[model samples]
Target: MCRGQTAQKSKRAKPYLDAENAEKMGEHLRSDYRDAVDFGGETGLRPGELCGLHANYVDRERGWMWVREVLVARRRVIRSFPKDEDVRAVPLTPKAIEILDRQLKGRNLTHGCGLEHTDGTECASALVFLSKRGRPMRPDGVGACVRLASKKAEVPAVSLYATRRGFATRAAEGGLDVFALADVMGHGDIRQSREYVQQTPTVRARVIAALGQAPPLTVIHGAAGASLGADRDQQPPSETGIEANENAC
Candidate 1:
């Protein structure tokens, strides 16, 4: 008896929220969750990383953030750690800066969560995101919120992690280096990050456009076929035999 399992080919791409769907989802989410969703999509951070984000991680002046820690999500319980035991900095774009500003605008709100430190401790603050009850946010809660918003937005159902995936895909499409993307995403394996650079409709369309830039080729199909742009002297006679009749005349 053969005692082996068959290996399957890896999927070229994973499903992710596109810009339009993300916007629509944002529109349907509650204000609190909307910002969280939008931020997750923009930064490509894991759900735990987003939930654990602290004000200190953001650098408004420099337009970048240090990803120092992440919230660990288990079944019905939450923990803390730095994802993959690695700390890295991710640069922010103008749009990301705008979103960060919006989050900071209401920092004084009584109902917000805090950060889970890498040392297995929780730090309380007017965190970037918080639960309605003023407690640290959890992945399950965020996931539930995403589901409802996607339904209301009438977009394809995608998980909260899809927001992160969307960010990676968009960044890759924007020509960001794959190795850099891996660092930004906190991926331990570069190959894991490469999966996000899968071929999409937009990428395919761009490829076609690029191929069209090549010079056009001309071909003669048959012995009597006229060459493209051929001069009168090199032209083939028409099927009507007009050239022969004219010569006879």
Candidate 2:
């Protein structure tokens, strides 16, 4: 089991959202949880990270959010260290805050029912997104919700992390250096960022079509000399001491 580390993604190439579909998926979500897919697909934040967040984490005026803390062990766990052992911040877009606010308000209105779920956590607890029963959401469960919505959204080849990886890749290509991107992603080694490179189909297709020509090929190795083309038959220069064709006296 991977311990104390974020999950490693086997492939880094992420898919892009066809926004129209994403919006459609919102309809499939339970009324109160509708924002789960939207927020996950927008923030590039992990499901756990989002569920773990509180309003305190947002520094809206500054346009960033502190992400080192989480709703773990049934309480907020703020790490002295970072997710990758380095401090990082995520820019807070108007869209992110908007959806978050809607979720919180909706949750509050729903959970005010004065009933409790398994954890006795109110449906409108301190979490950004809540389960139907007013309890903090499980990250895996959130991912499943998003995935299902994506399918309903008709967004093929997309997953929850696509947002996060897409964010990183877009940042990198937008002239944000690897170091800066790494910092924003809470990563220590930018190389570990292979997982965040968004090689969306559009990008990939453009790359190949832009090549416009075939790539250079290398030596045709593994062929025996006897089977080489006539061009390979040029004889080596005879030594001056050998008098051309005379087999020594």
**lDDT top scorer:** 1
lDDT (CA) per prediction: 0.63, 0.49
lDDT of 2 by residue, 173-215 (tens): 4556656667677666767554434333334445656888443
For model 1, residues 127-227, the per-residue Cα lDDT tens digits are: 56665444556555566667667778777666777788788888887887789989899888998877666453455566666988543242111111111
Off by over 4 Å in 1: 1-10, 73-85, 106-126, 206-249
Count clashing pairs, candidate 1.
1
118: Cα error in model 1, Å: 6.1
Compare the candidates by TM-score and give the number of the best one: 1
Output the lDDT of residue 78, model 2.
Answer: 22
lDDT of 2 at 146: 52
TM-score for predicted model 2 compared with the true structure: 0.58
Give the C-alpha miss distance for residue 236 in model 1, angstroms: 85
Q: What lDDT is reached at residue 177 by model 2?
A: 62
